[model samples]
Target: MAGSAQPSRAQLGSDQSASFRPYVAADQSPAEFTAKAVVIGALFGLLFGASTVYLGLRAGLTVSASIPIAVLAISVLKRLGGSTILENNIVQTIGSAGESVAGGVVFTVPALIFLTPYGPEYFRYFQILMLAAAGGLLGVLMMVPLRRALIVKEHGVLPYPEGAACADVLIAGERGGGLAATVFRGLAVGALWKSLSWILQLFRTAVGYSMARTSFFPNATVDLDISPEYMGVGYVIGPRIAGVMVAGGVLSWMVFLPLLTILGSHMSDPLPPVPASGLRIDQMSAQQIWSAYIRYIGAGAVLAAGIITLVRTLPTI
Candidate 1:
């Protein structure tokens, strides 16, 4: 006690807060959850919700709407008079909710409907609506507790990249100067590039090259999707995570596909779960082999990874 120094009040408070700073102070109340905000958010929700469902059904993947919602909310709210930071956040939250619900429903509900004996005819619109509502409610309930534990308690540990990025956009928009202009400029450039590539057909959106079939490696092909949106996502997620994603793709395309081709080259008969075309493994192209066999493998791997992650986090939950 003689030599030891006691912590100051500021230091104690800082330690308790875990270095997390709020955009709006606790003492201040802002114009959040207004009628206008709700209306705008709902309109955006409907727009994004429909688009996400379409994308998910077509591509079996959905993009997060949080950042886009935030950007749009700030821009729209600013144009229609001015808005508080909290109002923009409220709009973003409401709008992104639709995207989240659509993403979940499209990913699993269609599969359930088609996979059953009755097929899609068995499920009515009301049933689908109820299922989506229940799923959304369940997710919210689950996140209630987890949010406190993961987000509040372990603030610094779990770097929620999407949430952080959205927050940055909101803050920058609130400041309304160079930062806001920078964000809009990037969005404009991306829009122009996408329009040129996709709408005008100025250039190829994706490029692919098929390697010559050799004795050792057959049907080897490499492809790249040089979309502006995807490139923007890679930049946001950082190189390390992007590299891991690229590595997975390379492993699947280069390593797994080649090995499968080599092993199945001698097989005269078609593989089990044969494609609609009913082509033998040896006769099938690289894309056909991927669609028939590799897709299932990838799905199984993803399922296993999800289970493993859930098991590991059970204690924390």
Candidate 2:
């Protein structure tokens, strides 16, 4: 760390005309598209796609497989005795399609059956294949226009985190080795912590308590979760957005619970949903009110906010 030859963060992305620049240079000819590259890329794509399905089902999330796939491509190709940086780039580009398509279909296609009257039978093999195919095609077609503006023009300025990180991985791989190890280190630490928490049962992943038990404030819920991934995400997004999200949770548990109790306890008759014979608001638990009513409202509010943001950004896009 003391006498490192590596360029510091401050020096990156400053030179527009240099070979390090993202765009094509006059002196450099493009890498030939090779058959071997295509075959290898397809295999990695299939592998990542299958793994993504399992991950999405288990964790309800999937990471960008490009960096890891690139690292794997580099390692695998070098051993086969026919490899180049360009081939690695090609492999990553093609393989990345798998995870991207998987995310879109896994999240939406299955939900369509439930959202509609169509049963499981409606979502047959052909239907699923078509859905994924169309979605992938549409994504590619949309990106054709966006690539020049968003990717090239705004290369370093845009701050698209995933794209930037992938670039870093590829560049590091080309330079030598250490950068790829960082990805593995992260994977190891995450697996270790999760194993300690769940396997050993050392501590609850999330510890929560109602403020009514100890504090002057009634019905307030506090939760502390030892989730590095979530906390790191919060920091990356910055304070304002994270604070707004935390405030929403506080409002739901603290303000809404108490307010509902005050308003509903004194009701002359039970609300429409709550039968006359059933328990009143004062009788119901805070969790019941949240589950039955508040959650719907919260969902609608979020949907509205997303729509507003999209509308506001439409002109820029």
Candidate 3:
């Protein structure tokens, strides 16, 4: 039994050593690395940044689908015989910038318009851009300390599904596969859809509807239909998470909205009007309270989920 355990331990050690082997290692001067970084960064930055803007405009949803796209881009590049570590890292960093910015801008910058002297309508020009760039810098800084904890030490523990996908794309690129074309096609379709939607006013940002003001074409609501942005989201999220998102949407739209309207109608006599839009607790209802305050329960659940993941990964680190 002792002899058998020795072989098992030795095999485990060998497997880890093999897994740690670097693929597409680049031995180069600092200057060369810098140059490569700049070139790769610029390329991926444009690729992902453009993608973010397009998706944002199309769906009015700030999506982080760029991570997978970056990975796919790197994979295609690798398959084309240029699978370099420096290049791929540069791509990851650059591509990640757009997502980082989009996340921050979507969450924070919109609040600025409302909080500032001008309402969100005033930020139609460059608020999003400014916030996005600033968010990019913040993301870079935030992820720096995480490098050791996430990339180097954790290894396979955290999954880093995005990173792994990018690595695979890079590898595939080295082999001259069709991923490059597929990615480019996705980008083109996404961009065209966004541009056309904006021009055609497919959705309206009017005060009453919360941005889903498209005409009910052929007896169907536009929001319920899949668009380029939704397709991109589905691609990056895969099937399970996509299902979760769709479920959430259905719950919010079909269940919550209906329930709120019914409750509001029934309680209309007792309480004052809910008002067009203001932060008055007196005019709100149990449903409104649940939607506004109790929704934090869901936020806490999400936060707890993230914390639990981090905690589980701590042992691996």
Which candidate wins on TM-score? 1
Measured against the true structure, the TM-scores of the candidates, in listed sequence, are 0.76, 0.65, 0.61
Between candidates 2 and 3, the TM-score winner: 2
* lDDT (10s digit) by residue, model 1, range 1-317: 79899876445544656766698998999899899899999988888899789766644556788887888888888888989999999898888998899888887777566345475786788888998899889988998988776667656555678899999989988998434455578869988998999899999978997665574556767898887657766776678977876777787778878887887777888878777688887777889888778866766666787799999988655
Query: Regarding lDDT, does 1 or 3 come out ahead?
Result: 1
**Alpha-carbon lDDT, every model:** 0.79, 0.69, 0.56
Q: Give the C-alpha lDDT of model 2.
A: 0.69
Question: lDDT tens string, model 3, 1-317?
Answer: 55564445335544554588666444543222455455656666666666666565454445554445555546644555554545655666666665556555554454454345566666765766675667667767977898765566556445677667766665655455565566677779877776666677676433222212122211111145546667767776689977876776555544554454445445524323333354344355434544454344445555687789999867555
Candidate 1, residue 175: the lDDT equals 90
Q: Give candidate 2's total backbone clashes.
A: 0
Worst 10-residue stretch by lDDT in candidate 1? Answer: 8-17
lDDT of 2 by residue, 1-317 (tens): 88879753333433331324443345876553677778888898888888677665543446678878888777666667746667778888888897788877776665565444555769998988898899989999999999876655544555787766766766666667755565568768877887888789887788888755224554566776776555544655578977887788888888876677667667865554663247666566667766555765665675688799999978546
Pick by TM-score: 1 or 2, better one: 1
Predicted structure with the largest lDDT when compared to the true one: 1
